[model samples]
Target: MTVVEADGSFVEPFVTKNLYINSGETYSVLVKADQNSSRNYWITTNAIKAHHDFVQAPPPISDRVIVLLNTQNLINGYPHWSGNNRSLSLPHTPYLIALKYNVTEAFDQNPPPDTNDIESYDIYDVSENKNAISSNSIYRIGFNTTVDFILQNANTVKPNHSETHTWHMHGQEFWILGYGSGKFDKVHDTKSYNLINPIMRNTVPLYPYGWTALRFRADNPGVWLFHCHIEFHFYMGMGIVFEAGLEKVGTLPTSIMGCGKTKDMIRP
Candidate 1:
């Protein structure tokens, strides 16, 4: 069977019953159904290091977000992975990345601190803010631009409890730069980024209360979905979209044109 890397690259074919799939990661494997002809085989999945109960000291203010002054110095000339704000609410609406046809806009190359710089707080701290998660939240990038995203897992609502998330992206495969425990230290972590021969994959796993970094160029012209691979988490709103190169996206096919308010635009 062949395994797909985070950057959409193919790995040498191999075989294994035990597969590790992260929250947002997707895999395409080939299986030969050459088992016993009389009996059916059972397929199953289990989570390793699924539970955590270790309490960690709060992160220092300075460590909440680690900004990269020279993104160009990085392997792909993209921003580094900064941490995320530990919030449960749906951060924004779906389809926020859908761009109007023929619209051209320049997005800032500088890494934004919205997700990276925000500190994780106890869920109780902001429980009263009904709209803590903004519906208008969106991240836009220029076409063919390389981007680096750092996914950080923090303690869940339960004390001493952290969970694993499979981060997956649509439309493009990214290189798994690196993974580390605790908060992401730019200086220390950047030293370990795999610039050469890194596995290309669409989905990567993040250790509990740890961090994983990835990089990819947004060459595909469309609004792509990037989100946690876990179904329950996705249902609970753990995903976002990347709108890239809208001006280059010429037109929508009639098959995808009719829906909601656009029903009138459907072709016969």
Candidate 2:
């Protein structure tokens, strides 16, 4: 069961205990302790299969291309998941946020491309290598710039198999403009966009073989992560970072700056 405003102004009305909250979907349901306090209650979750498979193939793997600013200059490409190319590994040092006093490197002040102008494609078509996993690419933007992002899902290596990805933005809530199946026709889809009363959420799900478009302002300062909430997919490199508003960001806590270049700096 998902909770909405009392007047049902924003989202559609729905009530059910056994709800399938898709990836990129958020729910806030109020639960009252109406039962006995001493009794134990169990809430369970199980994975449901949308299609049957006769033979299980190995998990898909591929290399990721991380773009710093513009799509023209590709920064780096590394192995995304467990494969012969490069097995995925956790970074020893984490760059959570940059300190205002310590940061010296300047980021691009340009805004992201308009979503209406971008083309949407399936995973297979986008990757062109049949590898579902990709690199943790980042799209840097300036402060207060409006960004429209389109999340498109594609078919898996196994034919007729596609999965849902629940994308979550770290710093800001975005308006979910629209969702649709098949190739996302920008012209037709834009007509259906909900300009008013669209659902504003931090997480939104991209349906299997479908697309979801969202609009948000890059007002928050810092390097914010935007990734799929699914653990395995996240491990497989289904994520990206949005480095925004570096020009106005403040210093981060000294304790959290123990790693990276800040490690050598004297703590205050």
Instruction: State which candidate has the highest lDDT.
Output: 2
Positional deviation of 263 in candidate 2, in angstroms?
A: 2.1
Candidate 2 wrong stretches, greater than 4 Å? 1-92, 96-128, 131-137, 266-268
> What tens digits encode model 1's per-residue C-alpha lDDT throughout 192-267?
8877556778999877767787777778987786777888665454555557877886656655644433444454
Q: Model 2, range 1-268, lDDT digits (tens) per residue?
A: 4565343345565666786656556665656668998999877887675433432221121121121111110114433321211222333344343325434332222332323222433333323443322232345676777677767565544556667778888998777778888766757876888775677789998887777877777778877877778887667656666677876766556677665556665555
Candidate 2 residue 232 Cα shift, in angstroms, is: 1.6
When superposed on Cα atoms, how far off is each prediction in RMSD? 14.9, 15.1
Counted clashes in each candidate structure: 18, 7
lDDT values of the candidates? 0.54, 0.55
The C-alpha local distance difference test score for the whole of candidate 1 amounts to 0.54
